[model samples]
Target: MQIPAGPLLQTINSPEDLKKVPKEKLHQVCDELRQYIIDVVSVHGGHFAASLGVVELTVALHYIYNTPYDQLVWDVGHQAYGHKILTGRRDNFISNRKYKGLSGFPKRSESEYDSFGVGHSSTSISAALGMAMAAKYKGETDRKAVAVIGDGAMTAGMAFEALNHAGVADTDMLVILNDNCMSIDPNVGALKEYLTDITTSQTYNKLRDDVWKMLGKLPVGKNFTREMASKLEAGIKGMVTRSSNLFEALNMRYFGPIDGHNITKLVDTLKDLRNIPGPKLLHIVTVKGKGYELAEKDQTKWHAPGLFDKITGEIYKKKFDLPQPPKYQDVFGHTILELAEKNEKVMGITPAMPSGSSLNIMMKAMPHRAIDVGIAEQHAVTLSAGMATQGLKVFCNIYSSFMQRAYDQAVHDAAIQKLPVIFCLDRAGLVGEDGPTHHGAYDVPYFRCIPNMIISAPMNEAELRNLMYTAQLDSTNLPFVIRYPRGEGVMPEWRRPLEEIKLGTGRRLREGKDVAILSFGHPGNFAAAAIRELRAEGIEPAHYDMRFAKPLDEALLHEALLQYEKIITVEDGTVVGGFGSAVAEFMALHGYKNDLKILGIPDRIVEHGTLKELHRECGYDAQAIADAVRQMRKQPVSEMTIPA
Candidate 1:
């Protein structure tokens, strides 16, 4: 139980240093790295179990491959912490997933070793393929390309697509399928069964190896002998295993259901494969939470543990520091549970974000009413649409960025059919630490353009709760979307009780004469703060919180135009086709001569940083808004400062 100090981890600063260490000392380094991860994550919560599971895999890959020069892409990037520690990031691991610190996922900008950034699931194969193909095109044959994807990530269709392409291209690439037999939840589908079949094949490997050895002794030409060996291996594998030869069928060599935790086995197998020709797949069987007994015992809860006692491995609980109610998502969970209690037709669905969306509470309260549909966002959307047709009130909760995956489903199935399904989009803004891929910056723009969809952004938890209730009870015969930001809701003394706000209407939070600022969703609160700051400068700017994005608040907007010469629109989503664009489009059509400015997310992929940093970068923060307005008033049209 004694913790090792300093120089053990210090000497191993990078992968090169790791290579110099004797093989015998690897277990010691892994032990230290695992304990170090546990210590840091206990204080600053993050994806724990995943990193722990891949300790040896990380070590093996770094030991075998020339990383940074050779490309290593980690799918979903949640399990790359161990890799990070081995690749010169151990010192910064303490600040992992925290505000203004290291990201939870692999970031290309963070280090040279992280060849491709990934936050979404199933991107490793495609990214690795790209790097491999690029390497081939550039004639860089000396470098290796590797993709480490999870068994859960393998379920995604994109992963299969990459596999199919990689197999046919005959590119020199290595795909390590880390089969832990779980996603956030237990994996589902025919593919999962196929993998189970492959992993459980008792005699397939034995017969194939025996046949290869026999073929090795044949007195034939080298090319013919190699082709015959491959064919014989396939024929023997087919006879013994009825499961589809997915990778082999696509023309890639397949290896293992090997022991993923066995560092020696992993390193040896990788070393052998390094000399092999063409595309290859290595299926490594790993446990999700490999080391810590508590994490191993309850993999799901420990997937991302909060501050916990190292001895008992139990999370440390504390009372809330604020007098405010629970988060908007938490409130939605409670509300849905209550609604389901009365209406048996109610069902809750989430696309692999049960905990983040607060659907876990509902799942616990009424297991039948709530369901986790894995990482299939598109499937979840249409599935909800299917349930709605049966007269069921389906509440589909997903993160704002994730809902992008279901765009076609939203348009084709739900909106087109006008199903009464409630799409609750959580984290609908610049999510901190997780960065660009995880940001909820594009949902408003993406969803606003779709027909038969009513999108609303609530300012506080009470409003969010009411919106959910309203969406459920509305006989409008259309799909409804309620988007909210991550974390706690704003505290206000004059908070109103839950009530249905009229569709397409906006409430004037503050009345002023010179200018009007129209804000949507979470940014509305910041707009109000900016207004107060403007007032101190004798600029009494008006503030209006638009509840609905789709409806456009034409009446309120028209009224504002009549009273004010200058207008600004602010939202948390992209300005391209979002609330600002909606306002600008309306003003232009109406031939309003007033000068206008729009504020929202920019039209580029942002990187890993805190929400505050992103907002400041995008000019969505309160001080940024105040400065933008002040600058706009003082300068001409060409000289006015506008968000990029």
Candidate 2:
């Protein structure tokens, strides 16, 4: 586990330095970079196997293309660590994915080489196409645009849309489909098989090469020749290739089934394709966890490994102080399994987050009841709606941010039809480290507006469990979303069995006189802390935990308004259309306008930072809450302003 001294990585301050290095020395450079990543990640712990898998691809791309000028858009951007190391970030690699440090994803602000910012999946092709189209519009022909997308990301409908659009646009762009046969788990669907068919076809390549050579030799007019040649080449190749001519039909030229790990082959093929025109695709075969034995053997576990020994590749060990309750996601997984166990009609679904959402646990426990529908978020929602038609209870577990992709389906299929689908939304607050694109900030606002949807936020693990149980038994014939935050749940001493919590009722946590603090979701903990601080300052604030967003506790809210002159509503969601806004709407409807303060996420895209930092920035942290209450108390009685 001894890392090499500085000089090797120090020399690679930018992609230019990587380009300057002799190709023969790339293997040594890659070894140094890999070891550096291993050493750094062993302690810091970031996307492990993903970075390992892309070492050669990163090297070859940087070495081949003049980056910053030639765009390199990475899909998902988790595997951009190697690219980061080669592109002026080697010095700060240790600080990667930390608070106030380099981002885990490709950020345009971080470096010029990061041409496009990415965190979510299936955006590279669309973004690269934009860059390509822009380049064409500006009449800049020399520079190229490339998108390095994962096989898992390719399953997303957006990626297909981008591919479809790019093919017809007739712009010169390269899409390197980095096929490791895994997104989180292995990719599914007919497209995966189509890709496999193309990769395995030997005769297709021979026929493609002969046709391409013949097409190149034909002397039509210069401008018309390349277009006509590409069209003819694609047509003949499509006929020879038994696989579906999906990309070719879009008018993009297809290349490769090439070995991605082989540095020489990747570099040589890329160099050859540099002269080719129009949209080109290079389907590269790679291993998800390429180098390390442990990673290679268990790619899923190593996808983002914790601290591990470099030699034996065993993860660093630590025991929990208490018998750790399963992760919130795991609790949901087990609950789903339990529900399915009781009812054969219960179905479990996830949008490519089987492991992250702990749906894999359900899949293992009740394989017949669970399904991972790739990265197709929209598809998962509609599919659940379809399943619900047969009187099945479909529990769809998707991360909060990803759930945005299926908004139309949530409204049209589930909410509109009044389907009994339980949406288990994991990471429903400020998700740490992975940054803004992964933040679960918008789910509350988005799901709240739906007509037949009931949205509930649980304060503790017990409440989460109870909510899920209640949702199952209620037979509401409506869509219910249980939004929960990431990481460890609060260790509350009190325990309760699955009791039916009244559908639209909220419970009071604390009683005080001067002010009322209404909190939603996980932000209730912060409100509690703020209450303690307010008490110390002689301001006793009443605390109410509003469990349901849609069917808000009007009785509890009315009681709070009557008792407290000043009230504040807090949530870990956007202020514009979130919990605070719901309360505001309630007050307006009843014509009860007391001094009200709303606190939540602001109307801007928050950047990558620690959850604590983000919460503080958004004024949802305890200290911020305490300070706001103190400031409100200090305002003169005559000048005390209430928001309309």
Candidate 3:
């Protein structure tokens, strides 16, 4: 199934090669590239609509800029697919997001054209500014730094911070605001509303056009320079609309609300901006799914619609003979709504990830109670703390990786105040295909040391429901964390009656003779499977699902330690300072010198792949666990030493 690129696209191996294509043929190139993306992604399965959206812009940027030398940074990397294809990766494009293949995002190691590696949002402006500043310092007068950032990413405070500095920095940089009105979900907040107002206002646009026309006609040599033009533009903006545009007010010359899909227009606009020095912004309006009709209608669903029928416009799903368990996120979404219905005090908050965290369910049912705080993770945490001060239970749902952004707020605002903020950390493991930048690998270690934080993980959906039930109770008055992995849980019939799980407790799932496997979170299922496999080989190992990492179940641990001679701890998080480390600490504190082994994500950058592949690669999958037990069985257990 070799997908053929358009004849024009086939000629482009790099931006240098793209520069060779006649300007008239760029539209054909865009069409070919867009069609190629559709053809390959329909079968290979990577991010779909975002790449499709930016095809024209990607071509325009490469054509105008001397890339690799001239730095170009993509904010979140969702739209970098077209960029990659144009830059010598056309042949290997099918390997996108596959195991041991191309990264889904723009990666610096992967290509010289990828000036900055990005996975998280709202980082492009700052990163590009740095590159521009470096070029200035190095006296590279002709060099330019361009950042392609989305409207959704603009909602984050970090973007504003960078814009504030970039305004006065006097650097040769361009911030291309890709206003698609979406980032996985629809863009929210005042910024979104402001962008809408700018794009929609006929009066503003007409005046803007007149101003641009007047500025264009001004003399261009020594008498009238770029600075003079900038000042004149600023003066006109101040006099007419009181400088209504946000980017203009930041002291950066702002151009556009231009048609991003018009390849010629984009090329012309970018060429002109390259000559106009200082920090500037180009606000180009484009649809999230520009060429695809189905994607344009339903942008969110088509964002990453995995292995679709491109012709039929049907997203493929694996047909199951029996009912499969729902994703943990969906369960969280429904359960949070259920909890909100029961408790008037319960409110939901997510940092522009209501849909991702499944809090969208609650948002739909109780709009006022649940909020999408744009891309402001810190604001979400602090806002949750504020609500907690009023005795309201706020479940601040965030992706485990994204929560790293709000660590300060979690510590200073919530944990220090001991606000009973229930932090539901979704995708709290090696999230498949997203790679290291998105893996929820450090949450356990990061949060474990914080006092007044009750860190817990659920073994399955029932346990997750129970944990949520417990965390919201008035009796539970700590900053609670319930971290769960991505994708489906083990139980199909998981809509169990919500019951409160006692704090600082664990349950022994299986009782065996010599060895005990201490498991945490979703990886408990892996441990159970390994135990089953070992049992078939006439080796029975005990298993315990220790729900809480912060508060070790000393009684249960004591029971296991006394009976079992060999102990193995398993967690989806990093072994360093994680649940396994916590267990090791407990063992060390009590002076129990039993044979111990820890299995989890090693302290290294794990690349993108399927969850099963990552688990096996990290040596914690069922077979790996079973192998560990068998290896331990072969060696006689060391004599256990306990303090009297």
Please, what is the TM-score per model? 0.86, 0.91, 0.97
Query: What's the best-to-worst order under TM-score?
Result: 3, 2, 1
How much lDDT does each candidate structure score? 0.82, 0.84, 0.91
| lDDT for position 581 in model 3 | 95
The TM-score between candidate 3 and the true structure equals 0.97
lDDT of 3: 0.91
Estimate, for each residue in 45-147, the C-alpha lDDT of model 2 and write its tens digit: 7889888888888989988998889999999988999898888777677778777888999998889888888888998999999999999999999979999
Tens digits of per-residue lDDT for model 1 on 1-644?
22332466778889999899788777887787778878778777788899888988998899989998989999988899988888888777777876567878888778888898888998899989998999999999887899999988887667888999998876899999998878776776677788888888888867766776787688789656666776777787788885336878877788877889888888889999888868999989988888899988888788877789878887987677756556767777777887788778889998777777878888998988898877778889999999999999999999988888778889999988889889998888888777778889888878888888899998877777677767877465689999998776775332445576677788888888667889998788888888888888898888888889888888898888777777888898888889888888887778776778889888887665667778888888999888877876775543222212
lDDT of 2 at 588: 78
Any runs in candidate 3 off by more than 4 Å, and if so which? 214-232, 235-245
**lDDT of candidate 3 over 1-644, digit per residue (tens):** 56789888888899999999899999999999999999999999989889888999999999999988999999999789999998899999898998898999999899999988899999999999999999999999899999999999999999999999999999999999999899999988888887887688777677778877887888888998877876766665555553345787788888878999999999999999999889999999999988899999999889989998988998889999999999999999999999999999999999988778889898888999999988999999999999999999999999999999999999999999999999999999899898989999999999999999999999999999999999999999989999999999988999989988889899999999788999999999999999888888889999999999989899999999999999999999999999999989999999999999999999899999999889999999999998988888788879788767
lDDT at 289, model 3 = 81
Worst 10 residues of 1 by lDDT: 635-644
Q: Say which prediction, candidate 1 or candidate 2, comes out ahead on TM-score.
A: 2
Order of the predicted models by lDDT, top scorer first: 3, 2, 1
